[model samples]
Target: MAESLDTALVPAHVAVIMDGNGRWAQRRGLSRSEGHRAGTRTAKAIVTRARELGVRHLTLYTFSRENWSRPKDEVALIFDLLVEYMKGELANLLDQDIRLLVLGDFDGLPFVARQSLAHVMAKTAHCRAMTLNLALNYSGREEILRASRALAQKCAAGTLEPESLDEAAFAAELYTAGQPDPDLIIRTSGELRLSNYLLFQAAYAEFYFTDTLWPDFDAAELERALADYQRRQRRFGKTGEQVAE
Candidate 1:
């Protein structure tokens, strides 16, 4: 399937909203934890597929700040699965030359989970082929606020002139600082909204939404999304005639 894709049409950065895990489990009369486990498996496969399809950056909304509002037991299980995944996939990540990057405040995570992430990230620090970002405990609004505060601090200290602030300067403080903004953002489970994911970074991103749940999303579905993206005409803010010219 990857061989069929035109490498030039592939998005440089792809962000996914892996949703509907709990609903998937409910439909099968299984525990939500089981659904999450299945979702994790799907995530792993997609990571490999995306890398093979020439995606340079892949960001997964693994754990959001709003997810903490769910049942505490569920949250705990998610973190446990996260640790297990890190330990299990470290070798595969290294072999694929994929760097592991966190796009959220991982320091606020549980001690054990933090340690696991640190270990995996450290081990994959040298990888250069691709970058995989896990958005743990992340919120777009919070990220913007953090960046704003940092810039404000620099201004207060006279290190940065207020008039010198620009989009590039502001974006430099984001979690995705050195990475390209997402060119494609996919949301599973038929969600029509961004749900506060990558607010600033998604300014001009193309969105792909599917009815399939996160656990059911496969390489074929991903291929479809990418193909759809390739067919679209992205002119930024220019008119079609202007772009054609």
Candidate 2:
């Protein structure tokens, strides 16, 4: 399937909702933390494969604001894993020329984790090969609300007019301001919901769902998703005839 893919049809940006970690671990009689640990390995492999496949942007839904509701120990473990991954992968990220970008609320992160994330982001600022956006502590609704507040403040200060706001203008204030909207969004574990991920940006995206857990998703699964995306016809509301034109 990979061999027959039309490279030109590959989506420029791909987003993933890595789910089912707890279930994966439960099925194996391991702790949920173990599932998250295994998922990290899969994340690394997918990032490498995305770069190799010429995907310009790869956004992984690492952690969401809702995740904070989990048990304290579980949350701590997730952050710890994040710090460890950043510290361990900084060198490989630089060597591979992949820039690290974070989306969502950074202030909510633990101080040490925040420091580690900032360090890696700064160190890889010059990487131009591909962007790896980790959507940590992200919430699409919150993001939109934040952007709205910013715009509203500008308007209140007389520096901007409400009438002057356009889709592009509004989007510029978004967390994904400079990034292209995801062309394809893949969700593992057969989940069929967006779960507040890239809500604004996924307006026209093609979605692919798989029963495979995040801990087991690999390059082949990614290729299969891309292949599926390649078969889709994105009309962006245009009629099929108009699209053909």
TM-score of 2: 0.97
Of the candidates shown, which would achieve the greatest lDDT relative to the real structure?
A: 1
Candidate 1 residues lying further than 4 Å off, grouped into runs, are 1-4, 241-245
Tens digit of per-residue lDDT, candidate 1, span 52-164: 88899999999999999999999999999999999999999999999999998878999999999999999999999999999999999999999999999999999999999
Q: Which residues of candidate 2, in runs, are more than 4 Å off?
A: 241-245
Local distance difference test scores for all models: 0.94, 0.93
What CA RMSD would candidate 2 show? 1.5
